[model samples]
Target: MSAARDWLFADIGGTHVRLCRWGRENGAGDIVRMRADASAGVADALLGFERAQTQPAAHAALAIALPVRRGPLRMTNRDWILDPESLRATLRLRTLCVVNDFVAAAAGVPVLGERDSLVLREGVPGPGSRLLIGPGTGLGVAALIGTTGGDERVLASEAGHMGLAWQGAEIDALHGLGRTRWGRLSWERLLSGEGLGWLHAWRSGAATPAPAPEVASRAAQGERAAREATQWFSRLLGAFAGDLCLAFGADAGVWLTGGVLDGLAETFDAAAFLEAFDDKGRYAATQREVPVRRVLAGDLAFRGLARIVDGACRAPMLRLSAATTHRHRN
Candidate 1:
């Protein structure tokens, strides 16, 4: 393995890509954020960054929002299809590691300081996994498990794709709306940026959907429909989060982070969220015992990428299948 300083780290999501140079000694350098251009492919974006540097990095680690598998991979929310071998060859990198973006976020949790997170609920820490979930351009989920020997293991999950758990007339209506629009309904369909807009449209009965940010802004300004949408979004998030906690036995804690939630800081209904989170019938007491916190820092994925490069965390290197080869860049 090379020194961490020789590596470049990137966190590629549906909407944006963040890149930075990192070192074990100095941590992360200046971070560069850019809108993700799915049509151009990730390789071009990396190449552009390399060209701007005096010395291009020999190694790279990418924390991508989509699932990382052994073969050609397609992004769920973007149009890019990636081949690990092609990317390595194109970038001339000696080593390339790719991991689920939420795995990177989970890896960052251990390194977070007091100032990096705000506790939403206080609970007795238990000997179980810690869950990291967030909403951005898409939803992300991961579990952090600590072993007795003090080492930690992170499990990445596509839990966002799980079926919606809530039931009601409104939820039924939302499901019908989603089914008509996208042909499928999942937790992510109503728990992400696009989901927020969908909820706003349903609540407002608008023929045209407003953007997620616009909905949040309107909610902040006390618009009835927008406020109701955001509030509903929060409650649903809490319900889903609580369900995940039960499923994963995440009694240690739950950390919430993401651009969507961060943007809803003022408009987010913490009370409603907490109420729904602990609304579990038989396990209500168990839910209340699980601590919940909102991550204040925006550079969580970058921090985790730094840790991976510095040998603090182990991430799988992306492998490509010869049979499934595809060119990701033009």
Candidate 2:
């Protein structure tokens, strides 16, 4: 259990897979990205990386955007299924840790420096807990339970599928449009990149939908409808953040992550977000005191992985259901 031990790290998402190797003394090696092709399994991908390294890693720390509780952990956004036993045997590792991506993101909080995040609200965090919410290929939620001696425990959740609640007439109208296609609307349906595009379509009544980045770019160019939709998206995101704060009792603070929020950095209405975020009637004062910030560290999760491997953070041990089933794609 030395800091100089060789270890492999991965952050798997729906569209991309990030891989890097950490050495004993120098910290993380060069980070690399590869497409998360359903046709190629993660085992094969890791092997390719190992081939380039001087030696195979003794342990691996992986974070994925899916539920790893109970039975087989099926990816929410992709068809790939992962079994820890299969991976351990195939990669020839002594240990493997698979955590919810948000959990890893949450783990990175204590270690985050001022240069790693942009502060949106400057409030003194209470000792309760910290909340994290982000929308990328999907929405992710996690809580960091505060403890004595400043140690925190991470709790991962699949809150994206939770029913979207009403914020105002605008959210109601947006729901009406979304439900027509998705049947029951969830926050992720309207808060993610794809959701942003859908929001633009619903607002403009345009049959052809555009990607979220394009919508943001167009909005920057004075596209009225795109601008309006982006505003609505921010408002809804604020409302959701407020609701999560109440649910989790996270009086400490909240951190916004993911590429969607990052892409909207230039055009996002920070004031509007704060307005909706603190709009809770009775709890407005409480919500107002909760800090909100955006993570600036792109490698936070991997850093968290390093912490896990270094035993600096106490992440949940990877568990396998008694009935664990393995699926291979070749």
Candidate 3:
């Protein structure tokens, strides 16, 4: 494997870090998963992976679970902070690209096959924008806009931090509780792994919250409060997703992915979710007609990074200005 030809790709999330090597001849290799907290920081983790590899890669791309800006990057859910320039120097890479994790995930949308997703709702597929949203340690949102020339543009968003809307008394009460606990309420407050646990605790009137996995397990075992919490979670997710669809005019479709939903696959009520999704008043019929699907593929971010490395997708490369400030292409 020549250093100039081989590429390294990493998907760094709140809880886990997945890294893989890609080459022109062989494509992407097996992914190596590690706890995000196992290393001191992002640079340390990448360096550790490189040290273990037989030969270092000359080019790299990283899909990180944070807003990719001009300078250093800081994660919303984890304590890790990454400086791309320092990373490039430490790894001795000829080129480096870093993008929002959802941007990478959305890039994989055009390549999804029949086995990659499951239809939650059937509707007409038009030439409009496609919305990709997922819930994990935090919620993520991105849009894939198709151009007239056939090329696509990926738009990364921090829409998860938007204020959550509530209609019913039950939801209003939950919103109040969330505000009291967290001082403010965003969609991510009740849609993420930690949020699920908090929802279960609030619903059950428990002093302490259970972990997300335990809440799902209890729901699967027929626990009333746990089941209700899980159901509410699904419904809320649908409502928020619907709002985003309308906001982005994502008539093309909606693709759902994330660890929390994957874990709830066995017990998730698609009908309930769809019902809430289509409850958009006068636009209910239109909302019902928009296709919705749940992504079943694992390591989607890696698949996307592979596209960037293969030149199938164009992600903004990290560059340093003469003033030593970082800059990125739009």
How many residue pairs clash (N, CA or C atoms closer than 3 angstroms) in each of the candidate models, in the order given? 0, 1, 0
For model 3, name the residue pairs that clash. none
Worst 10 residues of 3 by lDDT: 319-328
Residue range 1-330, candidate 3, lDDT tens digits: 553337888988999899988877777788899998798989888889899888888878899999888777889999988888888888887778788899899888878888999988779977789999999999999988875236666778999999988687777767777679888799999899988988898889998778889999999999999998899889999999999999999989999999899888777777778889889999998898899999998878877776655656655545442235444454
For candidate 3, report its TM-score: 0.94
Sort order, lDDT high to low: 3, 1, 2
What are the clashing pairs of model 1?
Answer: none
Between the candidate structures 2 and 3, which one is better when assessed by TM-score?
3
Cα lDDT of model 3 overall? Answer: 0.84
Off by over 4 Å in 1: 1-4, 147-149, 315-330
TM-score of every model versus the real structure: 0.93, 0.91, 0.94
Worst 10 residues of 1 by lDDT: 321-330
RMSD of each: 4.0, 4.1, 2.2
Q: In angstroms, give how far residue 224 of model 3 lies from its true place.
A: 1.0
Per-residue lDDT of 131-181 in model 1, one digit per residue for the tens? 999988888999888742366667779999987878556678877776787
